[model samples]
Every structure is written in structure tokens, then in C-alpha cells.
Target chain A: EAGVVQSPRYKIIEKKQPVAFWCNPISGHNTLYWYLQNLGQGPELLIRYENEEAVDDSQLPKDRFSAERLKGVDSTLKIQPAELGDSAVYLCASSFSGGDGYTFGSGTRLTVV
Target chain B: GESVGLHLPTLSVQEGDNSIINCAYSNSASDYFIWYKQESGKGPQFIIDIRSNMDKRQGQRVTVLLNKTVKHLSLQIAATQPGDSAVYFCAERKGGSYIPTFGRGTSLIVHP
Candidate 1:
């Protein structure tokens, strides 16, 4: 089966610009996640969705970051007026459920200057 | 024996030797544990996983050990190869939550 798919594998934007990333989870998977991975560090959860409802978004920066999963199939993560600190890999993952193992996409590498 | 950032340890082993990587999980309530291998410019790929009820599990040329008492997890790669050189991370999932917490990852270098 095909794994989770993400769009725009790499992106470059100037500071204060608006950027968006898209993700499509695997078929039959009910859980989707967005994570930020800094250089030489593990992924940090930004938001998690169980269907269309976001179950965990405590780690997300609501000031500039927002994520939405519509119809429980596709997800979008956007950063308006992105800052230089937002440069990193944005990973999207999917799972059958909370207990199931996750499958991640190649991720979108964002470089904010 | 040393850390790069946030205890991101690095391990080096010969190709013909066995290699072991260790991880320390934080949540005692976590019931599922997984190990992931990630190459440069790529996302994490599943390696192996073990439940809280089990202490050890093995796969082809790979092994995972879970110690619930101390919340320690480990991955063993037998007959390490140059292809095994990458960053490995451990993740834990709680019984009722869908979010999994990930470790800082370890850099494994297999010398040929």
C-alpha cells in the first residue's frame, strides 16, 4: 500500500511570508499528525487529528501556525507571516489508530530566510 | 559515550560486528513502543515495535527490547552493514492517546 503522501517536498520563503503544506493520509487510516523536526533532533508534535477533529494541538503555536483536516482524509498546515525559526522539516504521519504504528511521508523541508 | 544535542548519542561499529542502540522513554503509561530509522533527507521508517507486555522481540537481523520497569528501550542490529548508517529514533504511545512521543534519535555509523 502506498504510504502517506505530502506535497512540495521542499520550499523556500522569505521571513514574514505565508506558507502552506499539504498532506494526504493513507487509505483507511483514521489518525493524522503534523510534526516539526529541527536539525539533528527528533520530530516534535504540532497537531494530531482523529478524523476531522483535532485531538491534540497543545504543542502547536496558535499565534502563527494552524492546521486543519477536512473530511478526515487530507490535512493542511499553514504558517502565516512565518519567521526564520520556522525553517525545518514538516512531517506528516498516519496510523490506523492511536495504538497502531505510524507511517510518515518524506516531509516538506521549509527554508525561511 | 558522548552527546551531540539533547542527548543525541552517536554510535560507531564495524560492518561485521553487532550494534546496539539504546533509548529511554519518559512515560510509564505508554503501552506501545516503536523504533524508526531515518536516512538523510528522508522521513522516519518503521524498524520494529514492542508492546509493554513483552520484554523482547526479534525481526530479521533486528531485535527490540523493552524494559517497562525503568522505561528503557533498545534496538540491536546484528552483523551491521554500511547501509545501517542513519539516525534511529524511539517513540512511545500511551494506552488511550493517539499521539506518540519521540526520542531525540541516535546516529549510527557502520564502518565497512
Candidate 2:
């Protein structure tokens, strides 16, 4: 089976500009997650979705970051007026359910200057 | 706040030798733990997992040991090869939650 897919393997944007990353989770997977990873650091959960509903987003910076999972299949994470600190890899992962291990995508490398 | 951390930032081993990576987690309530290998420019790939009830779980070439009493976790690789070189991360999931908390990874370098 094909693994989780993410678009635009790399992206460079100016600070204060808007940026978006897309993700397509595995087929039949019901849980999707967006994580931010800095150099030499572990991935930090930004948002988690169970189908179309986002169940966990407490860590997301609501003022600048927003995410959506439409139709419970694909997801997009948007950062408006991106900051220089936003430069990091945006990873997407999916699991069959809350009990299964996650399958991660290659991730989108975002660089904000 | 709950957190997971590794004892070493990097580990170096000669080929054909055994490699061990250690992690310490603060959450005693965590019931599930996973080990992941991440090569440069790639996302993390699952290596193995062990439940809180189990003291050890073995995979093809990897072994995951869980010490619930000390809140410790370790991953051991037998006959390590250069292909095994990568950053390894340990993640813990709370007993009732699906969300996992990840620790800073340990970079493993296998010398051939």
C-alpha cells in the first residue's frame, strides 16, 4: 500500500507571507496529524484530526496557524503571516485508529526568511 | 508537564556490534511506547513498540525494552550495520489517549 503523501517537498517563503502545506493520509486511516519538527528535535503535534473533526489543537497558534481536514481524507495546514521561527519541517502522519502506529510522510521543509 | 528524553544525543558503534539507545519518560501513566528510525530528509519510520505490560518485545533486528518501574525505554539493534545509521526517537502514549509525546532523538552512527 502507498504511504501517506505530502505535497511540495520544500517551500521557501518570506516572513509575514502566507504559506500552506497539504497532506493526504493513507486509505482507510481515520486519524491524521500535523506536526512541526525543528532541526535535531522531535516532532511536535500541532493538530490532530479524527475524520473531519479536529479533536486536539491546543498547541496550535490560532492567531497565525489554521488547519482543516475536509471530507476526512485530506488535510491542509495554513500559516498566515508566517514568522521566521516557522521555518521547520511540517510532517503529516496517519493511523488506522487511535490504537495503531502512525505512518509518516516525507514532510514539507519550510524556510521563512 | 510530561516529557520524554534520551540519555545520549548520539551513539557510535562499529559494524556487527550491538547498539543500545536509552530514553527516559516522565509520564508513568503512559502505557504504549514506540521506537522510530528517521534518516536525514525523511520522516520517522516505526522500528518497534512495547506495551506497558510487556518488559520486552523483539522485531526482526531490533528489540524494545520497557522498564515501567523506572520509566525507562531502550532499543537494541543486533549486528548493527551502516544502514542502521539514523536518528532514533522514542514516543510515549498515555494510557487512555491516542496522542503521543515524542522525545529528542538519538543519532546512531554505525561504522563499517
Candidate 3:
């Protein structure tokens, strides 16, 4: 079975530029999540999606960060006018409903200069 | 504002020895716990998991012990190898919730 897939494994952009990351979860998984990880720290939840509906997104920055899960299979996380602090690894994970563990992607490492 | 935290930021062990990593969680309502191993430039990979109802769960050479009395969780890696060198994180999830909160990771360095 294939693991979670993410594109543009490394991204470098200037501050104030827009950047987007994409994720394709494992087949048949019903739950998807987006997380941000800073250097030397664990991942922090940004948003979670149960199918097409976002059940929890309180941690997402509404001013510039936005996410969408279309058809509940693929997801996209965007940060508009990115800041230097936004430089971190963006990780995506998916799991089966009521499953024991989650499958994670390799993640996109974003570098904002 | 419950949180999960690790006791050690880094641990160095000789290869073939056993290693223990510890975590403490503030949320008593969290019923599900997971241990994830993350390598450089990669996302966290699930190593083992234990529920509140379980005190211990074992998989491969990894074991997870949950002590609800003190809200402590631990991961034990036996016969550690160089491949086991990575950052280990403990995550907790409340009952009836799928979202998990991750703690700062413990970096394990297995010296050969």
C-alpha cells in the first residue's frame, strides 16, 4: 500500500509571497489533517477534516492561512503573504475511521526568507 | 489548555542497549496515546499506541506503557540500533475525538 503523498518536498519563497502545499492521503482514509512543525518541536495541529467538512480549525490563522479538502480525498493548505515565522515543515496525515494509527506524508519543508 | 510534554530533550544510548523516553500529559480526558518516530526532513511515523484501558502495549521491539495515575507515558526500545536514532514524540487524544496533541520530541541518538 502506498503511503500519504505530498508534493514539492522543499519550498523556498520570499517573505510576503504566497505559498501552497498539497497532500493526497492514502486510499479509503476518511480523516485528513494538516499540521505545522517548527524546528526542534513537535507538530501542532492547524486543521482537521472529516471528509469534506472541517470539524476543527480553531488553530488555523484566519488572516492568512486557509485550507480546503475537496471531495475529501485531496487537501491543500495555503499561506498568503507568508512571514519568516511561517518557515517550517507542513505535514499531512490521514487515517481510517476509528483506526488505531495515522499514516503521515513526508511533509513539505517551507523556507521563508 | 492541556498539553503534552517530554521530560528529556535528548538521549544518547549505545547500540544494542535499551532506551526509555518519557512524556507527561496534562489532560486526564485523553484516552488514546501514540508514540511517533520522526527522522530529519520527514514527518512522524507511528511506532506504537496504547489506550487508557491498556497499561502496556508491545509491538516489534517497541513497548508503550501508560500510567494514568500520574498521567505519564513511556516508550521503550529494545536492542536499539542506529536506525532507531530519531526524535520521538508522544501524542494524546481525548475520548471521542480524532485530533491529537503532540509533545515536544525526545531526540534519541544511538551510538554504534
DockQ, every prediction? 0.68, 0.83, 0.78
Worst 10 residues of 1 chain B by lDDT: B1-10
Residue lDDT tens for model 2, A1-113: 77999988999999999999999999999999999999888999999999999988999999999999989999999999999999999999999776475799999999999
Where does candidate 1 stray beyond 4 Å?
B1-8
lDDT, candidate 3, at A45: 87
- List residue ranges in candidate 3 displaced over 4 A: A99-101
True contacts kept of 3: 0.87
Sequence-dependent TM-score of model 1? 0.91
lDDT of 1 by residue, B19-91 (tens): 8998886667788888899998789999998989999999999999988787778899999999999999888
A best-first ranking of the candidates according to their TM-score comes to 2, 3, 1
The best candidate by DockQ is 2
Task: Name the 10 consecutive residues with the lowest summed lDDT in model 3 chain A.
Answer: A95-104
Q: Of 2 and 3, which scores higher on TM-score?
A: 2
Measured over all alpha carbons after superposition, the RMSD of each candidate to the real structure, in angstroms, is 3.1, 1.1, 1.3
What is the C-alpha local distance difference test score of each model?
A: 0.88, 0.94, 0.93
Q: What DockQ would you assign to candidate 2? A: 0.83
Q: Candidate 3 residues A3-101, lDDT tens each?
A: 899988999999999999999999999889999999878899899898999988999998999999979999999999899999999999999877544
Query: What does candidate 2's lDDT look like per residue over B1-112, in tens digits?
Result: 8799999999999999999999999998899999999999899998898889899999998999988888999999999999999999999999788777899999999999
Instruction: After the best TM-score superposition of candidate 3, give how far the Cα of residue B72 lies from its true spot, in angstroms.
Output: 1.2
Give TM-scores for every candidate, taking all chains together and pairing residue i with residue i: 0.91, 0.97, 0.96
